[model samples]
Target: MKIILSPAKKMITDTDSITPDGLPEFIDKTTEIQKWLKSKSKEELKTIWKCNDKIAEQNFNRLENMDLYHLLTPAVLSYEGIAFQYMAPSVFEDSQFEYVQNHLRILSAFYGVLKPRDGVTPYRLEMQVKVGIGETKNLYEYWGDLFIAENSIENPEDIKGFKRLGYAFRPDLSSEIEYIFERKIETMTR
Candidate 1:
């Protein structure tokens, strides 16, 4: 059973809380992407990032001094978005942490799929970002079905987790390859 999640735009350095289990699965691929990003000029990056001067400059500096291997934080604690804040991984017990490590995966444009405790550095890249990498026109084409296969569910028991999150299994919307979990608006508001 695996619960796939999107990486957050806002991230922070948190090496003090929990140590990372290991580096991402596709570190070499990440290095390749990093090199490609480094080749672009700041103005070019600003255009690619689609941001104003200040944010572009900050990420440009991050690209300049980015070290993929050092001063890493666990992927779960690196993000500062609403979803991550709600997750509240900082207060999780050992059993909860273990469950997350085994069943949760975070999808990243920069690092591919990340386990909960995977070592990660702060970077600004989204799955929808259009950048030429190798022969691919955009990240969607570059990633293809890799993430889908990585997060594919083989066990029927996996469906139980979604129920706990207020998501009901939608058999009408689901097929052999896709499992849809829909939460009602009323349930979400609560």
Candidate 2:
């Protein structure tokens, strides 16, 4: 199976802190961050693409860096006059271990193994979903899942079999993302 994601866009912490090189500095204001992100020119993107390609070639297991730029690095999402962080499937997975921002993994329009229940459509709209097992679905069905808080979640779309927070996004993430995926694969194997 192959996994892909978007760029690792940086966001300023908005506080004074010592850098890894032990430099004292303070990060305040979103405009500063935006300027930094915009500083990357097309040449930089090409350079990064070459470097990331080498890394991918060396570490063949990781997903490929196919784009010249982080294409999925969409403009920042603005909510309530504040900029909420952007969520890219590639980026979210790359930084999933960091566990900072939780989001739905988009699994639509790809050639990959396994998929979420129902499909990726509902998950993309931020709606709850119910995935089904024992079915051989294509890439469209493999968006994985998002766990909304109890009572804080909205009603799921028309799909059924998507077990609600019946599981936790704890240590066992594979299960948390798609509980039915394994069974579906096993069914296919049979």
Candidate 3:
């Protein structure tokens, strides 16, 4: 079974950790997005990133010198959020690493879907950002069902099993074909 995880906003270079197995599946599409990002001014980027001037400047520099292929870090080790800290890839055994490499996928605004060992440079783009690219009005439009279509389950009923992870199916919160799964903070803390 495949498990999808959200990408962290905070990322770091850790080429020393685990070597990336390959590039992201949608590198060509990522290149197109990168080109669009490169065209924006720092101020424009700050707006799009919804970050402070300092963060904007840092990411602006990263954008200017970004190389998608060289000095890459494995996606699992690159992200430095609380979730990643809890997972602690640094201490993972070989068997655990192999399992994650096979089953885990990270969702990214810049790279779309990434395997655990996908080579990725540090980038700052959120899926919710409203930046226009070509004729697309926003990142959601630019991505356009790629995530759902590529990652969809063969049977809709299969998702019900995820409730074991503390998620409750929220039919009231769901819209049309979309299913919303939510867990209480108390459940999450456990």
Q: Encode model 1's per-residue lDDT on 44-159: one tens digit a residue.
A: 88888888999898899988999999999999999887778999999989999999999998878899889999999999887557778888776755765564354474665564
The per-model lDDT (C-alpha) reads 0.82, 0.25, 0.82
Worst 10 residues of 2 by lDDT: 117-126
TM-score for candidate 3: 0.79
lDDT of 2: 0.25
Name model 2 segments beyond 4 Å from true.
Answer: 1-64, 68-146, 149-182, 186-190
Clash count for each candidate, listed in order shown: 0, 9, 0
Q: Clashing residue pairs in candidate 1, if any?
A: none
Displacement of residue 45 (Cα, Å) in model 3 is 0.3
Candidate 3 segments whose C-alpha is farther than 4 A from its true place: 151-190
* lDDT tens digits, residue span 16-95, model 3: 97788989989998999999999998889999899998899999999999999899999999999787899998899889
Minimum summed lDDT over a 10-residue window in model 1 is located at 158-167
RMSD of each: 6.4, 18.7, 4.5
Point to the candidate with the largest TM-score: 3
Candidate 2, residues 1-190, lDDT tens digits: the string is 2222221222122112211221111112212322332344544433433445544243222122222122222111111112133333222343552332232222112212111111110001111222222252322243332222222445433123333323222234334334332212113353
lDDT of 1 at 174: 78
